[model samples]
Target: MPSQPDSSQLNNGSSAHRTLSGGGEMGALMRTIDWAKTPVGPVEKWPHSLKTAVRILLDCRLPMYIAWGKEFTQFYNDAYRSIVGNKHPAAMGISAQETWPEIWSTIGPMWVEVWQGQSFGFDNFKLTIERFGYPEDCYFDFSYSPVPDDTGNVAGVLVTFTETTEKVLLQQRLQASADQLTRIFEHAPVGIALLSGPELVYEFVNEPYLELVDHRPVIGKPLRVALPELAGQGIYESLAQAYETGQPYIGRPQMLLKRGQPPTLQHCAFEVVYQPLPDQQGQTESIVVIGFEVTELVKAQREAELANRAKDEFLAMLGHELRNPLAPILTALNLMQLRGTSEVERERTIIERQVRHLVALVDDLLDVSRLARGKLTLKKQRIELAEIIAEAVEQCSPLLEQRHHQLELQVPNTGLTVEADPRRLTQVIANLLNNAAKYTEPGGKVTILGERLDDEVLLWVRDNGSGIEPELLPKIFDLFYQEQQSMERSQGGLGLGLAIVKNLVGLHGGRVTAASAGKGRGSEFSVWLPFALATQAEETLEVIPNLSQPGQLRILIVDDNMDGAEMLATSLSLYGHTIQVAHDGLEGLKAAQSFLPDVAILDIGLPTINGYELARRIRQLPELQKIRLLAVSGYGQQEDRERSLEAGFDLHLVKPVDFVDLNTALFEEQP
Candidate 1:
C-alpha cells in the first residue's frame, strides 16, 4: 500500500539533507534525522506525493507541516519551528499523535478525516500543546488538507497554520472599554446629546435629554425637525454657529414651550451649552449639547420679585394713609401744649402718648421690611458703650415706668467703645428692654448687664418675667412670630421687634442669642459686638438743641390733606415765622414763586403734580433757586429719600414729625 526507501537511502543522511535544504533552522535539523526508524520509512522510498510536499513545505515562508503514511509522521519548515518549541529534530520524523499528544483528542479525529480524502480548516482554532515541556492554551488559523500519491489515493495530510492569540485578546479589551463609556453616557444627570453633520442630526440621545423634549422620538432626526417649536428661538442657529466656528455656545435661562394636550402652552426655562467636537484632522465634525432645566428656580425668583413689589406698594400706601391722619393730631397736641391750657391737660398727654406708640409700630413695620430686602444702610461711628447704654435706658424708661418693673444696670464706665450705627444700636437695646417689661408681671425685675470679653463687648438683658418655652426659644427672632396671649392682647405689638434687633445686630458684624431654663423661669438675651481698636478716636456725640426761639423766616407748607397742611402752617406760624399753605402741587408751585419763601415743606403724594415734579419746577425758577426745599411725606424708604434729593430737595423727613425735629429742620443749616 506504501512505498519504502531502499537500504542506501536509509543509511545516507546527505541525500535526506538535500531534500530538506533551503528552509532556515528546521531545514538543518530535518537533514540529520534518521528516517528509517520512523513510521514513514526512509526519504528515498517515500511516496512521490509525500516527497513533493516536503520540498514545498521547506521552501515556503508560511507555517506548514505534513503528516504522511499510516503512522501519520510529521515534517515541517522553519516558519513552523517556534510552534513546536523544543520538539524539533526528534519530532521531525515522529507520529502526529506523539508530537501533539496533549491535544490529540481534539485534532486526532481531524487527521482521520483528512486521511479519508476530506479536507478541514478553522480560524482562531483553540488547542493545548506540550511542545515547551508544559501545556499552553493558544489560538491559530489552521487547515488540514489531504495529499494524494501517484495512484491518486489519499496518502498524507498537509497542514498550514499561523498564531492568532494576541489579536483575539486585543479585540476583547477594546469591546469592554466601549461598553463602559456607553453606560456613563446613558445615566448622566444633565440632559446630554450628540449631533452629527451640518444638518444637526441627533446621533445619540440619553434618557435625560429625551425627557427634556417631552419624550419625543428624536434620535436620527434633525434638530429642526425634532423640535419644530424652536424655529424662531435661536437655538438651532446657536448650534450651527458652534459647528461652523469650532467654538462653544453657552446660553442663560431661556424660555422653552413644550407640546401638551389641549393645545395650551407649557413654558419652561433651560440653561444649555453647545460644544463643537473636532476630528483628528482639526476640523469640526459634530456638537455635544448639555442642558439643565431651571424652570422651577426661575419661577420662584419671579414670584419673589412680585411679592417684594406688592409689599413695597402696600407699605407705601399704609405709611401715607396712617401718617396723614396722625400728622394733624400730633400737630394739634403740640398747639394745645403751646397754648398752656391746664384744663384737659391730662387728656392731651394721654392722646400724645398713644399717638407716639402708633408711630413706633408703623416704624417697626417699615424697618423690618427694609432689613429683609437688604436695603437699609448704616452710618457707623466710634462711640463709648456707656453712652449707647444711657440713651437706650432713657428710651425704655417710659415703658418700665408703665409696667412698674424694677431695672438694674451693670456696665463698665469706660474703655468699651465700638464702631456702630448709634440709632440702630439704641433701637436694639430698647427693643430687648421693652420685650422684658411687656412680658414680665408688674413687679418683675429686669437687669441690663454689659462687659468686655476677649475682643468683643457683651451685653445681656435678663428678665424675671414670663420665661420662654423651650420649644419656642429658637424661633423667637422670626418675623411676625408672637407668643400666645390672652384675648385682650395686653402685649400690644406686631412681633417684629426681636426680628429687627437680630437683623440690625447682624449688619453691624455682631451676633445675638436667647436662652431660658423653661417657661416661667425667666429668659436671658446676649449680644456680642466686635470691640473697636483703642487707637481709633472716639466721636463726640452732638446734642440737638432746642429751637423754640429760632429766628422768624418765611415758610411754605404744601400738602393734599387740608387738616395736615393747616395745622402745620399754624405750628410754624406760632414760631414767629411767616407761613403760606397750599392744598396741591400747582398751588404750592405758584405760592413758592409769589411768596419767595425761605423754605418749602412739600408732601410727596400731592394733587395736580407730585412733590418730585414740584421740586423740579421750583428749582427751575431762577429767582426761587436759593430757597430751601424740604420733602415731608409718609414714603420714607431710602429710594424715596434719594428721589427727593435728585429732585432738588435739601431734606427728606417722614410724616408725623416731632415738633422739635421740625424746628431743627427750619433753623439748622443744610448739609
Candidate 2:
C-alpha cells in the first residue's frame, strides 16, 4: 500500500529526472521494464525502476527532455534546466514548440526522423535555442533513436546530446594553425617536404619543392618516383641513415642534373631533418627535408676566380717582356749618336722616341695595379713648378706636332716653387698636355700657365681643342673610362692617364680639377699644389755635362744569342770603347781575362754561368775587381737591381735602357 508520490516530484514529472542522466544507464535499463504493466506512476507512488532511473538521470551531464504530444515540456534534471533556463513552468505541462520557437528548426527535423522509426546522428550541429529569455548560438553532437512499443511501432525518440562549443572552437584553432603552416611551406624558396619509411614517401610538397625536382608529382608517392637517379648517386643511403638515427644530414655543394630536353648540372646544398610524426599512439612516422639550389652562385664564383688568375699572369709576362729589350735598345742608340753620321743620328732619334713611348705604356699599366692596391707612393721635394711644366711640355712635344697644335707657356717670375715629387708632377702635367693635344683640332692652341698663390702653386693647362661634352666632364678622372669619341678611334689610349694624374696629385697633397664649356669649345685642367716659400727663384740650367770620354775603354760583352752579343759589341765600339764579344757566360769570362777592359757590361740571362755567378767570379780576381762592373740586362725591377748590387756590380741597368741617362749615371763629367 503505497501513498501517492509527493506532489512536487509528480509535478516535476519523469522528464526532470530523465534529463539529468542524459537518458543513459539506469534510465535505459529501467526502460526494459513495462511501465504500463508495472505498479508505476501516481497509483504506486514511486516504483523501484522509476527511482533508479531518476537517480541515474540526476547524475548525467547531457541535457534531455520528455515532451507529451500537446502536453507540457518537462525537464527532469539539472542538465535540461541548464539548456532551457527559467523558460517553462516548473513541471511537465507546457507545449515545447510554443515555449521555444527559435529551436524548432532542429527539433522538427529530429522529431520527423525518430517518429519514422529511424535513428539519426548529427555532428558539429548548431542550434539557436532560447535560454534565459535570450536566443544563443549552440553547438551540439546529438543522436536520436526511436523507442518501440510492444507492437514494434515507434512510440518516442530517445535523444542523447552534449554541448560541443569548446570542441568546435578547438577544431577551428587547429585548422587555422594548419593553414598558417601550409602558407609558410608553400612560399618558401628552398624545397620542403615530408618523408616516411625506407620508401621516403612524400606526404606534402610546396611549389618550389616540387619544381626543384622537375615538377613531378611527389605527394602520395615515394621520393624515388621523381628522383630515381638519386639512389645511384648515394643520396638515398644518406637520407635513410639520418632517419633511422633521428639525426640530421646536410650535403653541401653537390651537383645535380636538371630535367629538360638537354639536361644541365645544377649545384645544390641540401639538408634533411628527420622529424618523426606522432600518431594517437605517440610514435615517430615521418621526416621533413629541405634543400637549396646554389648552381648560379657557384658557377659565377669559379668563373671570377679563373679570370683573376689569368689577368695576373698576363701582367707578369708583359712586365718581363717589356723590361728585357730596353737595355740593348738604349745602348744601341747611344752608340749610334757617337757615330755622328746624319743617317745613323736620325735613325737613333726614331728608335729613342719609340722606346720612350713603350716605356710610358708599361709605366701606366704598372701604375694601374699600384692604384688599385692603394700603394702608389710619392716622394715629394721642393720642386720648381715652371721647370716641371717645361719638362712635361718637352715630353708631349711630339704629340703636339702630330696634332699640328700650337703650344704656349706662361710662368710667373716668382713664387712658382711647390713642395711636390718632381717626377710625378712632370707626369701629371705631361698626361694632361698629351690628352689635350690628342683631342684638340689641328692648329689649335694649348697654353700652360704657372702662378704662385699664397698657400699653393696653381698650374693650369688650357687647350683650344675639342672640348669635353658636358656629361663626360664629371667622369673624366674615372679609371679606364675613356670618352666616347676617344674610344671610337685608334688614337684612344687605355684611359688611365687622367686617373693616374688625379691619384698622384692627391698623394702630393694637391688637387686637380677639369672644366669645359661644352664640346668643340676647349678644355682646361687646373692643379693646385702645396707651395714652399723660396728666398730666390732658381734659373733654368742650359746643358747637363756629358761624362763619357771620347777615348776608348776595353769592354767584354756576353750573351747567349750570337746576334745579340755581336750587335751590342758593335754599338759599344762605335761609342769609343774597344769591345770583345762572347756568345755565352763562359766565353765572356774567358774574354774578360784576355781583354782586360776598363769596364765589363754583362748580360744576366746567359748560357752556362748565370750573371750573378759570373760577376762574383770576375770580382774575385784583383785586376778585374779594380775594373768597373756594369750589369746591362732586361731584368730591371727593384728586386733585380738589389740582387745585382749584391752580386758586386757597380750599376744594374734594365734592358732597353736610355743611353743618355745611363751615360749621365756612369760619367758625371767627361774625362
Candidate 3:
C-alpha cells in the first residue's frame, strides 16, 4: 500500500515535476502548472498508464490529448493548443468537461465507452464548440482508445484527431454550385446540350434542346444516331473539330433538314456554338452546344428576294409591250412630214405632241423601276438652278397649256448653284410640275418658287387644286400609291411621278417633302438641296456639226411591223437613199447578201430568226461583210443596249427613233 503524501509534500512543485524536455510551449505550460490543485492531483502520483499516455501525447506532431482519472482531467500536446484557441493556457490542466462544455453532450458518451475498455473512431464528426469566444459549428476526424493502468484496467481515454471543418464545408459549397448551374441550364430559353466522349453521347439536354429535336428520347444516345438528319450537314464535323482541337466552333445561320413528327422532311435554320469542356489534363472531354432557331427569318428573306425578281421582270415586259405600238405611230408622223401636204399640218402637229407625251409617261415608269432597284446612276455636275428650272418648265409647257393652267415662276437668276445630275434633276422638277398641272382643275394657278436658305437651296412647287387628304400625305411618295380616284381613273396617270421625284432627290443627297391643307384645299411640295460654290468655268453648249448627206446608197430595212418598215423606208427614200424592205430576219439576211446594201437597219423580235442571229448571219456572208448594222428595238433597258452592242450592231437605238439620229448613225464614224 502506498501512503498519502503530507500537504507540504503535495504542494512541493519540484517533487511532482517530470522532465518533459522535447515538447514546445504546451510542454512548458504543463511543467509550470500546479497539478496539486487539479482533479488529477500531482503528476508524480499519476498511474503508469496515464503518465505514459501524457508522454506519448506531448511527443506527437498530430493533434492528440488524454483524459485521465475519474474526473476526466485534460492533457494535450502543443499541436492541440490551436484547436482550443483563447482557452489554451487555462485549459491545459482543467477537466475535459470544463474544457469543452459546449460539446460535452455530443462527446460525453464516447468518452464513457472508452472508459469501459472500448475504442471508437469517427469521420467528419460534427460538434458545436466555443473556441473563439463564439459558439461555432465544426467537424473533425478522430478516434478514442482506452489506456490501461498498472492493474490492467481501463482508466483513461487517448484521443487522436484532425479538424475537417474547412474541407467538409468546401465540398458542400461545390455541390451547391453544381446544383445551381443545373437549374440554370434547365430553364434557359435557347437550346442547350452537353455531349461527352468521342462518340459524342448526349449527356444532358435542356427543355429547349429537347423541343428543338421534337422531344425525342436522345439522352444517352450518340448525336449522330439521335439526329440522323444532320448526318451530312457538317454539324458532326464541326463538333469533332471543336473536340479534337479544344477550340470553340461558331456556326453561322444555315438551312438544316429536320425529320418532323409525321416523318416529313422540313427545312429549318439554326445558329449554334460548340464549346469544348476540358479536363484536368487540359484535354477536351465534352462539348457544350448552344443554339437559336431562325427558320422564319431565313424564309422571309428568301421570299422577299423572289418577289423583287418577279417585279423587275414584270416591269421590263410592260415597257417593251407599251413601246411597240408607239414606234410605228411616230414613224408615220415623220413620214407625213416628208411627203404630206400642208392642208393637214395642224392635225399632224397635235397628233405628234400627244404621242410625245405618251412616250414621256412610259419613260417615267421605267425610270422609277430603275431607281427602286438601285440601278440608276447620277451624272452629277455643277449647274445653275435656273437652267434646271427652265428645262423642266419647257417639258411641262404642253401639259400646262392643254389644261389652261396659270403658271408663275419666281427664282433668282444668280447665287442658286448646286452639284446635281442635270438630266435627273430636270426630271425631278418636271415630275412635280406635271403632278401639279394634272391634279389641279383647268386654269388653276400653279407656282414655282426658289431661294437660297442658309447652306441649302429650297425649291417648291405649289398648286391650288384638289389637295391631298391628311392621311394620304405620308404615303404619296410610295411607289404606285394613289388616293381614291374615279372608277374611270379620269386623272389618266400612273401614280409614279412623285415616287420618281423622291428617289431622284435622294440620289442628289437632298430630300423632298409635301404638305397640304386637306382635301379640296391646295398642296405644296418642297425640295431642299445643299448649296454648292459656283465654279468660274463657263457653261458651253455642245455643237452638233451638221452631217453631210451621204451619196445614194442601197439600204435594207428589216422590221416585223410592216407599217413601221414601209414608213421608215419612205422617210429614208425621201433623203435620196435607195431602200429595200424585209419583214423577217431570214428575208433581211437574204436582202443584205443579194442587194449588197451599204447599210442594214434591223429590228429585234423578228420572226424565224431574231435580229441578233440575223446580224451574225449577215456578217457570215462574205459579200455583205462590209455592210453596216443598226439595231432598232423597243426593249431599251441598259442590259438590252449592252446585248445589242455585244451582238455586233454598229449602233443601238431605242424605238420612236428620230430620222435625224438614224441619218447620223448612217454616216457617223464607227468604232
TM-score for each of the candidates: 0.78, 0.54, 0.74
Q: What are the per-residue Cα lDDT tens digits for candidate 3 across 139-234?
A: 889999998898999888889889999999998899899789889999988999999999999999999998889999999999999999898889
lDDT of 2 by residue, 1-671 (tens): 12323446544556533432345443433333333232223313443433443455456676755442222223244566555556633333235566667777758777876778778788978887767767777788877766554455654455667778789889888999989988999888888888886678988888877777777776788877767756566677777776666666667676665554345544454443445454465544677788767777777777887776576446545765776666456656666676676766767788888877787777787677666656566666676787788788888888898778888889864567787777878999999999888888788999988887788888889998778898898899999888775335855578899999999988888899999999889999999888887657554544766455645677777776555566677765656778788877888788888888777778887789988888998998777767777887755445567899999888887556566565554443221
Error in Å for residue 123 of model 3: 6.9
Q: Using lDDT as the measure, what is the rank order of every candidate, best first?
A: 1, 3, 2
Clashes of each: 2, 17, 0
Best by lDDT: 1
Best by TM-score: 1
**Per-model root-mean-square deviation over C-alphas:** 5.9, 10.6, 6.2
Clashing pairs in 3: none
lDDT of 1 at 579: 94
Candidate 1 error regions (>4 Å): 1-191, 197-201, 206-250, 256-268, 273-285, 292-297, 534-545, 669-671
| Candidate achieving higher lDDT, 1 or 3 | 1
The model with the greater lDDT, 2 or 3, is: 3
Candidate 1 minimal-lDDT segment of 10 residues: 1-10
lDDT of 1 by residue, 120-222 (tens): 9899988877755787778899999999987999888899989887786676668778677667878989999999999999999889888788788998999
